[model samples]
Structure formats: C-alpha cells, structure tokens
Target: MAAYESAIQSRVDCIEIDVSRSSDEVLFTLHGRQGFTTDIRKHKF
Candidate 1:
C-alpha cells in the first residue's frame, strides 16, 4: 500500500498499525483515508 511508503522510507524504530480482528479471524490494518474524516468501524473488515 502506498500509505506504507512514508513509514518505510522514514525507517521508524516502531510503527503502529491500528488493527481490529474480526470474528472470522481477519486482521484489518488501518490505512489513510480520502478527503473528510471516515469512520473505519462502519466496515466490519
């Protein structure tokens, strides 16, 4: 994902990714959004 480019380039010691594990055992890592603020919870991942 392009959003990861910044983190990769920066070489940060620790990068946190907001993750939500669904009941189906799927992990969702938070990525940037479009124009306005978005409620990522709206999607069950």
Candidate 2:
C-alpha cells in the first residue's frame, strides 16, 4: 500500500477508499470492491 500512501501524501484534495464489513463485523478496505471507483461501505446504524 506504499503507492496508495504516496499518492495520498501528494497533496491530494480528496481521496476515496472502499470499505466493507467482514464476517466478524469488522471494517476493511477493498480496492476491487467496485468497477473503477472504490466502494465505501459502512454499517447503517
């Protein structure tokens, strides 16, 4: 994830990440979750 970090550190105005709940209800970052753009998922509650 070095590249990702570098890009973010390059004075990016905005950044997006994909997150999903695991079997244990834990959140995770998934790059390939969506086609092209990242998918950020979170608990409704």
Candidate 3:
C-alpha cells in the first residue's frame, strides 16, 4: 500500500503489483516473483 502511495505522490502514470495466492488460498499483492523474501505458497495465510 505504501508503494502505491509513493507512486501516486510521485505522479506516476501507471503502477503494477504482482498478485499471488498462498497455500491457504489467501490472495495478496507483491512486487515480483524473483528475489522473493519467502515462498508464499508454502506459508498458510
């Protein structure tokens, strides 16, 4: 959410967010697949 705010403040024309589903079927947004801090699929949200 902070990233989106920052982009809005910077007057960005467009923004992108990566959405993924966890093992528990919880949906969330992230930046990218590469260099992920943790495996969302393995964690139960």
Candidate 4:
C-alpha cells in the first residue's frame, strides 16, 4: 500500500495498521469505522 511505502521512505520504525472488520466479517486495515475518506482524521492518517 502507498501508506506503507511512504512510511518506509520516511524511515519510520513501524507502521500502524488500524484494523477493523467488514460487514461480511473479514478483517481490513483502515483507520475509521467507515470506508476510506469517512472522517477528517482519516486524511491525516
């Protein structure tokens, strides 16, 4: 993912995977409860 790539480029020690589950019960990595671009904070993350 681009985020992981960016973190690696920036020399980050580790990257956070903000995980959650979908309605179908599959796990996914995202910051907000909603899908991509749900919240203003999502932009920062």
Candidate 5:
C-alpha cells in the first residue's frame, strides 16, 4: 500500500500492479512471476 501511496504522491499518470482475489474474499496485490499462473484461491494468505 505504501508503494501505491508513493506513486500517488509522486503524481504519476499511471501505475501498474498485479491484483488477485483470494477465496476468503480478500483483495490484495500479487507479486512474482509464479503469481501470474498460480491460483491464489488455493493458498492461504
């Protein structure tokens, strides 16, 4: 979240991020190469 805040503070036109929703219905950013294909719902945060 700090990174997002920093980007906003920096006045950047756009920011890129990876987002995923867990089975528990939680929303958060997903990082790493494996995250692209991995199903976060199967894993616990």
Candidate 6:
C-alpha cells in the first residue's frame, strides 16, 4: 500500500495498472493474477 501511496505522492501524471473486465462489463485494477489492490473497479463508469 505504501508503494502505491508513494507513487501518487510523487505526482505522477499517468499510471499504468492492469485491468480486467467482468461479465457485467465492470473493470477491475489488479497488480497480478492473484494480487488485487484497491477497489477501483467499483468506481468505474
């Protein structure tokens, strides 16, 4: 979690995170196959 916070604190303009789509057309941000970070998927429009 600190890694992600540090990345944000660095004022990065853009970030690249892996995303996957669900059957309901929802998008999720995942670091790897079994690692998931924050629940950004719920905020997707």
Q: Highest TM-score: which candidate?
A: 3
Local accuracy of candidate 6 as per-residue lDDT tens digits, 1-45: 555567699997666677899999999876543556555557966
Worst lDDT run of 10 residues, candidate 6, spans 32-41
CA lDDT, every model vs. true structure: 0.72, 0.65, 0.77, 0.71, 0.75, 0.70
Q: Which ten residues in a row have the lowest lDDT in candidate 5?
A: 31-40
lDDT of 3 by residue, 1-45 (tens): 887888799997777777999999999987643665665559885
lDDT of 1 by residue, 1-45 (tens): 666778688886655577889999998988757566565547785
**Segments of candidate 6 deviating more than 4 angstroms:** 1-3, 23-25, 33-45
Candidate 3 regions with alpha-carbon error over 4 angstroms: 32-45
Q: Which stretches of candidate 2 lie over 4 Å from their true place?
A: 33-45
Compare the candidates by lDDT and give the number of the best one: 3
Q: Which residues of candidate 1, in runs, are more than 4 Å off?
A: 32-45
Predicted candidate 5 versus true structure: per-residue lDDT over 1-45, tens digit per residue: 786788789998876788899999998895454546655458985
Instruction: Report the Cα RMSD per candidate.
Output: 9.2, 8.3, 11.4, 6.3, 11.3, 11.5
Of 1 and 4, the candidate ranking higher by TM-score: 4
In angstroms, give how far residue 18 of model 3 lies from its true place.
Answer: 0.5
Per-candidate TM vs. native? 0.45, 0.52, 0.57, 0.54, 0.48, 0.40
- Model 5 reaches what TM-score against the true structure? 0.48
Residue pairs with backbone atoms closer than 3 Å in model 1 (clashes): none
Q: What lDDT score goes with residue 7 in model 5?
A: 72
- Poorest 10 consecutive residues by lDDT, candidate 1: 32-41
What TM-score does structure 1 among the candidates reach?
0.45
